[model samples]
Target: MAITFSDLHTEKGIKSLDQFLSGKTYISGDQLTKDDVNVYAAVVEKPGDSFPNAAKWYHAVTSRLAPSFPGNAQGVRFGGKAEAAPAKAAATADDDDDLDLFGDETEEDKKAAEEREAAKKSTKKKESGKSSVLLDVKPWDDETDMKKLEEAVRSVEMPGLLWGACKLVPVGYGIKKLQIMMTIVDDLVSVDTLIEERLTVEPCNEYIQSCDIVAFNKI
Candidate 1:
């Protein structure tokens, strides 16, 4: 029998999903489909570690839907409480026959196909791993030359490092800190190594007193 979850925002619904996803990769079958996307969109946040199965499923679906995950968290209503069971079967049947023999597809089918292709490309790209970072480059004092400091920070380069937009923000006194953005390939760059070995030492250190990561996000 197929399981149907309701009130997906509640603990009871999440637990049901967790149990359903145990030893499974996708919500319905072996491959990702609109069902996964719909259920994933319904849940408000990543499942905590307490729900190990659900949490794992969440992250797997997340990586699979990268760059195009839904922004909204509105709970999806499958059907009225009375029609839940049939709705699951109907949805599954629809997914199975999205494309007809003539190769004609509904607009919704086309969009879903496009999103699936995009997800595939994103998954492949993620194999190399990458992250976007924002760093706060501090100066020793207000007298520090902000222009030269920025130049020095940008000077240090590596195989995976690409510098991006930057701006200075007032600290308290006349001192201003440089907020810089950078993208790095995870395999080729280590933020800790960059700070401990490069930015906080030698030539770059002349203008940079210390460096702290303001934000780090996977791309």
Candidate 2:
């Protein structure tokens, strides 16, 4: 199958594009690494099984479109995985102190083995402790609404402007009125600039519903 401006033929695609620009949807069941997400995105947008072609396109477009270095902005994060110090070697002072230093049963070699195991365990903890993203929304309403929204933010313990806003739009509009104005709360890579670009289009909808989504550093 072939794809083009006309080939993106889903009802969601049409309606979304009309209501928002760059009507692209990146859908996934579980979380994915930045690279994995991009690759996944390319594959999904492709017409058929030409995933390799999709990969190439994804890489090429991302190379130009994405702000940060490869796999930085959008990727899985595991805290303290790298540069983690190994655990202290098992103290063998309690064990037989008379063991030889060089023999297979020697204390010195046993210590080395224990050290390696400790290092592996430490590394695993660092790799698995990465956090997941939590998305929250704030809508544009009257003065009372803003107060309510602020209270909601406080209840969630999220900070100000650090999160984004998005709307579940039903109208087929994109790139025009910019229904979502994802204001930046942090000096994050590409977010500020990307948000500006996304707003280049109009945000118009006959029946539009909107909410704001921002990224809050999950404490």
Candidate 3:
């Protein structure tokens, strides 16, 4: 349940983690695409399987909740500093209403919304925040750095609570191979393994490093 100094440094990885203890998007990077978030759910929520188009999210979700030893970044300690991993896979699709993707109604949420609206109208302040992903900056956009980044991916930890945080399942994708790659990223333990299994060659380390699996700590 211990969030390292690194995770806290990023705004997108763990949104207001100290102030908001639970909810999806609370800790994972803001740059995460819809697929990234969904894959996160499959890995932790439905570990041992990969649903299409959700790999990066799988990595982000698992790192925050991977079953780990105390003080380590693996295994999520849910319902406390970290939420506990659910004991069972959902019994049916109809149970969606029970999922708690965001935190419940609280005085803080109400006050914060009011304050934000007041600030916007009174000052008309337009804070300049950037989107999570900037296609222009992606290393893969440059072949040279991509190699180096994948190496970094191998060393990072992904947790499992991502499953609890989401409920995404892809029906299809706009691009074929890209969707396939997305599938590869969906398996927490096997994103890298699947690459090796299919390609019979190691993928670039940058593929790993460029990975946006890192998440915000919510405990």
Candidate 4:
């Protein structure tokens, strides 16, 4: 019978029990029986909302059967009441007490935390101070002056400029551009001066037409 009723799988069939159980307290005769348990389990396996009769009967039976159990049935709510505010507050206090078992931080631990945070901020500041620049270096004619171009790029020796990769790229129309990637210190004024000196100096200036910064970005 349980399998047969469950296999019905129809809304009307499942809700049919609502009227049947309206005047009765149990699914079989008037008292609880194996038939009631079997029917309740079958109904719960179906959609809870579509089988309102089944959901109500399942809850009614389970509550009476396991009222004192530590846990409630999954997906089945009871009484529709939340925990009282005082009880929730008490639970929070208990959680705090449990966490307090670890004790307070020592002075050394506090000092170490401060030192770590300070070091982190200092590192971030140093990184933010550094910047990258892309320079477009062109020669006078179709001829390429690799040595002069490289010499010019390295001529400006400054503490702020940390030259990384220097390469000559050949662009269209017989012009080769010099791409220079470097890291500079926080002093932007010194960096600008160094770049100005590199482009205006002899060997580099003789072979180069015009030098301009194409792109710039912070690290």
Candidate 5:
């Protein structure tokens, strides 16, 4: 019941926002209001294309809200590097727990935490120079075997390659999606080539219709 109500509330909110901002420059009026700030903060990480008016308002407000720094320019640096996409949806909610979101912290506390993590990661990168990449795999037809696809991806070889996680997500219409993450040394060129060649060689290619590198960055 709680989940149902939450879903209904979200649906209604999207509809209300779309209707309310039809002729307005901001959520409240031409001038900025607390309401606009609140909504923009809540959905800034979400893909803008899904909500036209909200996207426009979010970009317009956030562009002004973002602070400028001297050296970095970008105010904050949490993770080592940004992922290709923010991932509109995850295979599991906990999948992103390790990524810092600056939640429920005082300004000083958040800054200190980010600094500590960044320092630690910088040291590790100096030692290992490793990175991570996420791949999205899909089948061409109903006849394709999922087990083979998984086995094929698992079979790829790379020096210093470390398998992270693999999960299947149902994307509706009786179709599903496969996502896998792997860590590797600073050899993206070789790793990418190996994945492309291996996935299409024999048994793996028989099942996998398409595969793509969704996210790749140093961890």
Candidate 6:
């Protein structure tokens, strides 16, 4: 059956994705594709700890697509409830040779197949070792330019860091805090280091007074 999710930013939609991903590695097939990319894009933040399956899938897709993620796609809008689109069929090899059931396969072909399987396994292992984090960045005062603060925060880029969606939330007395989501490879990014060294230091600190981790969950 085709899986469907509502507005991915909502709890209901995230739960739907979590349920659909249960016991499944990829959304449409055994490998990652544009289908995974589209769904991942729709999810504004990491799934909460309550939804483990969706969290795992989120990090897996993020880790795979981080290097060259499609940041410039002008997304299509569906009028009503959006359904998960099916993955496109992969192009098949056009080998004209007929299969010889009685004949042994070449040693080179066996080695190639083994290599592919090994790569897939490696990717899965890597995917499981990542984490997602949500941070609340408070500014020095109400006068602090939130746009400049966000730009400064985003400027601190690292190899394993992938920033997600963010929005300003009202704190009190006309003050707003920046709540942001990000995914990280466990070994590559230390949340403590990011806050102490990059975020609450130097130029970033000019706008950002303090930072607190709202949630952290392993994928």
lDDT of each: 0.76, 0.31, 0.32, 0.57, 0.58, 0.75
Show the lowest summed lDDT stretch of 10 residues, model 5. 1-10
- Model 3, position 196: C-alpha lDDT score: 44
Badly placed stretches (over 4 Å) of model 3 are 1-60, 63-103, 124-219
Q: What would you estimate as the lDDT of candidate 6? A: 0.75
> Candidate order by lDDT, highest to lowest?
1, 6, 5, 4, 3, 2
Clashes of 6: 0
TM-score of 5: 0.39
Across 111-202, the per-residue lDDT of candidate 3 in tens digits comes to: 87888789887664343221211111123332334324433333333432111221112223421111111211122334434334422234
Q: Root-mean-square deviation of each candidate, in angstroms?
A: 18.4, 28.1, 29.6, 17.1, 23.7, 23.8
> In candidate 5, how many Å is residue 18 off?
79
- Best by the TM-score measure: 6
Q: Which is the better candidate, 1 or 2, if ranked by TM-score? A: 1
For candidate 5, the per-residue lDDT at 87 reads 26
Q: Which candidate is the best by lDDT?
A: 1
TM-score of each: 0.44, 0.21, 0.18, 0.38, 0.39, 0.44
Candidate 2, 1-219: lDDT as tens digits: 112233233444433223322223322212212332323232223223333333333344333333433343121122512111110011121133332212345464578689989999988755542222233332432222433333343232122233334333332232111233323323232433332333121231111223233432422
Winner by lDDT between candidate 6 and candidate 4: 6
Residue 183's lDDT within candidate 1 is 99
- Write candidate 5's Cα lDDT for 26-111 as tens digits: 76577554444445433424324666775566555544444332232121122533232122111112332242222355565678
1-84 per-residue lDDT for model 6 (tens digits) = 223466897998989999889998779755664457568657766677999999888777655544332431122123433223
Indicate whether candidate 1 or candidate 5 has the larger lDDT.
1
Cα distance off (Å), candidate 3, residue 105: 1.7
How many residue pairs collide in each prediction? 0, 36, 44, 0, 0, 0
Model 6 RMSD in Å is 23.8
**lDDT by residue for model 4 (1-219), tens:** 222354324567667766566656667555544445445444533336655656666566554434333364432223542222222222233242242212466565588789989999988867656678777767777775767776767776666777778777888787677777777776553555655666656756776776777777876
